[model samples]
Target chain A: MKNSFVELHARERALSLLDAKTAREIVGPLDNMISPHLEPQNIVPESDDGIVLMRGMINGNNVLVVSIEGKFQGGGIGEVSGAKIVAALEKVLEENKQGNTIYPIIVLDTGGVRLQEANYGLLSISEIQNVVIALKKYVPVIGLVPGRVGSFGGMSITASILSYLIATNKARIALNGPEVIEQEAGVREFDSSDKDLIWDTLGTKQRSKTGLVDEVVDDTVDSIKDAIVNEIKTKKDAHRTENVDFYLSLLNKLDLSKKLDIDSYNKLYQSVVATKHEVPAATAGNKEGTKSRGRLWFEKLTGIENATSSISTVLHAQKDGKEYIAIVPDSDNKFPRVREGEVGLQEGFAVASIVNKIVADDKDKTVKRPIVLVVDVPSQAYGYQEELIGIHVALGSSAAAYAKARQAGHPVIDFIPGDAVSGGFLAHGLQSNRMIALDDDSITIQAMSKASAARITQRTIAELEEATKHVPAMAYDVDNYEKLGALYKLVKGIGSWEATDENVVKIKQLINEAITSLDGDTTLHFRYQTPIAKASGRKATLAVRKLVDEEWSK
Target chain B: MEKLHFNFDTKDAISKPVHVGVVASGDLEVIFRPTDKETEVNIVTGSDGFKEVWGNVLQRFFDRYPIQADIEINDFGSTPGVVNLRLTQALEELKDEK
Candidate 1:
């Protein structure tokens, strides 16, 4: 009889991977640590917060297995759950930094952000990515997707950053689920009930063949263990998010006129030649570009009116020794889903290409140019083709670029004058160390659209709205988002579209203020260190961090 | 969500702490810690108005094996059978450790 890894819960999964009798669980269920946000929203809180942090040996090598219990709330990452992952990974980073050499294996079975605790999920996921990038300097950070709510949403983007990825045939990986696409785009874009099409598009076998997932294995525990052990020995890093040239070249070949199918996409995937493509800086176009808060702000800040680039959606320019990047809407864009400025395949790859260029240009400079992100994305492009082509990698590419830029000591700042929602926000806004946003109600910041969030959480729109009043993280408006203490300065008296001469000056001063306050700090610790965060925003996160730090060396 | 607390005057003292089950759909997680005091059960369940069912289930469980422990259950609409099965599962682990 074969033991199926996918059938086990998170704790059992972690134990099955570790050496017998050597496994010790940190922050176990008996600790009484639960999500503070759940019960208040009438949701039952899990004892261990659906995350299992186990430390032991994998084949006599030091290992830490972080497993997400998919059976619980679809493994949705809440405040406590997100903090648990961030704290454990940070401990791994500390251990690796001190030469202890503990391998961190993440078993991903998440649907990205927990809608119940939305902003914290985004913040925690970004923090987790930062630690993963830092840990890569020492050892390979391994990832495992063992079916049963396989990696989706922002966690899939995190999966793209891991050194190596292994998934069983039982798993399926994508950025947005089919149901979400149907809810957001339309039923014609993706029929949520069409299970066969979904599996064929997102299943691990297709993913492996198309280079989304690195390797696919049998669902047996022994097979997954062997794969993990082999990856540890070989130190195989897919560098899935670093393949900017390949994706850009693939995008160049992709004909937007025809709807992409599996066979044609596979053909295109095999035919990519990976040419050295460089995205030129944003320039003043002859005609006025599509109007958006992002485009308007980019135009005012960069002083390049009608700012447009060859990529059409992505606009980047250097002004006064600072690099400004924006993903704006183009109503006439050939990619139909991204016309309203969603972070689509082209926008993600294009932003990565531009940011990577900036980092490369300033590689040896002590005074690295600060990168400002003019964020106004409504969401990530929701379409069948975007999912089929691995939009997570596109989003991950730019996110990894921004993280790498910030990690390399270039101050990354986000100026959110408009909507920053879902994967669009994850790919663009969340990586910045300091965020300066307008105190305007026009801005909508959240993990998913209300309709999709309601459907996914099995709550009515009214119930979801009611919960938002109690939980600041659940609310979509920027005013509610500020309660999370993630922003550096929420500037008042400035409307989203009112970029007057004086307003632009005020915004510019705040941006400079944000950059100077960085003081060479690269970590996302500023979010937690804020006064509001300490008081209530991230109170649970702080406690979890303290607990994990105390429990790590034991 | 409903919170329920129960106290049982049991005699057999549990030797160690044990945990079993998951708070998945139609299931529940039970955590047991050894205690010198009376056996206490505290539950935060997704289902409402299950106080009688839970009491009966615990009554039958403690009748068979009166183990003194601090019990905490986080349930998500598990049936009486599942509640008994998970309690028995934790009981089996307790016996295995012994």
Candidate 2:
């Protein structure tokens, strides 16, 4: 109970780890950097937007401690909060790049993307992840889960991408929260009221035992700080998301008929011998595949109708030296949660295998193969099995692969024709340099489903829908998403289901144009630099980044 | 959400800005910025029709301290006691630094 790190607020938590008079808060509460999106929804905004960014020394090592306030909005990362993290981490990345070793430690206590800010939360989290990946090259990016609202949703996928994760027994980490799973997949799938079951599956102790979290420390401030200091001093790196082959091998060993409990999953996880997994391009088959927009577009673009692959859900092929990947639905797939084309275990690992292979193959080439992702994912598979086996890592693997591919000079593009929701979008769509979506009302694009988001945010579906009308970030349709200026281009004259020959040709030309526009630039800064992003979509984000840059130096 | 603003005439003037508290449930954040003009307290609270109660709380505090500053409070259904606590915390922050 003495100097408990988990008990302290976000600001106090940041200051506790730093030496006396050594801590300097960047974009602190005095800066008045509140979320502009909250007030319109009649929600009272916090001055720091529930994020405390501190730049100081941790045990004499230059460090940036980014703490999320669990008390405020369940530590949700919205526009200002996400921007503060991205900007601060990017600054740390810059400092580390200059041979000044500055480690970035994220005190994660978030519920991931704030459903209120919806698309912006997704965009900001992805931006934060992109910067984290870049910073890992210079210094080990450490993450700490100190209880209350443990990392979940898109941020857990980000957590899985960290160099090392240190957590107390008070914390839990998973891609989807228990309540969200219950809402999406029913109570039989996961009982939200069962606190024991929830904690047993997602607690840091189990996570540490299963390798989801690196270390489980005591609740004291000293213990948490010591773990962080030890990690920085030792430069310990977990490389959590790089094990595509191992996860693929693990997925191969999974038995689909029966329910997988926690103990059985742990045993299966340990018993697996990681073998090489090579997901080949989809080839023509006699039987028709599931007819989703992603599948339709993949078939039309690649001219491989009735596309069949070793992994049924994941289909990827090289057409004109440009690699195309899509995750489609399988009505009779072995994995039930992923039957509706959700980015589940196999889809994530298989996409990672394919993308990793593409990156490896193009390592020596002068020009890298441009990856076109046909994003039509509904949501991540929201069953207990997915969370029990750590689906965050699966999502993280693909996300990291795409980010690395882009960083390695491969132009990763998202051609969203269907749904682009939650963790599936993060793993597949959000990592790209450019995103082009069809101008169709049917294409649902947001952080979470309306039903689940309403439940989590404690608002009725009607209230949630009403809020969306005021805030574009809260909207579910792709048109509202485009308003955020996240898309590289909102392609018109084509329905989501309309992938005709001429439409395919048009899309292919747009894809080529988007790739050419990159001009060897690999950074996700393109999103911020876009006309829509600059105009209004990311106005607060731009302001937050500017303030962080100005204050980080001071 | 309701926005309430109150102005007070005060003698003592402070020249430091301090922020305290989190806008959590049943809690609020208070920010005090030094002002050359008349002292004022502005609040955006989640609970409506608390204008007179907030006035009483702030009026009581200012009667004792009479600090001249521009104070802003973002309250999320915090009781009068919590508001007084955060306001007093912000004053302590100011005095400690001074």
Tell me the DockQ of each model, to 2 decimals.
Answer: 0.83, 0.91
Worst 10 residues of 1 chain A by lDDT: A1-10
**What's model 2's overall lDDT?**
0.91
Please give each candidate's TM-score.
Answer: 0.98, 0.99
> Candidate 2 residues A403-515, lDDT tens each?
99999999999999999999999999999999999999899998888889999999999999999999999998878888888788998879988888889999999999999
Residue A169, model 2, lDDT: 89
As for candidate 1, its clashing pairs are none
User: Can you tell me which runs of candidate 1 are displaced by over 4 Å?
Assistant: none
Residue A501 lDDT, candidate 2, scale 0-100: 87
What lDDT tens digits, residue by residue, belong to model 2 across residues B1-98?
88899999986888789999999899999999999899988898989997889889989999999999998899999999998899899889987953
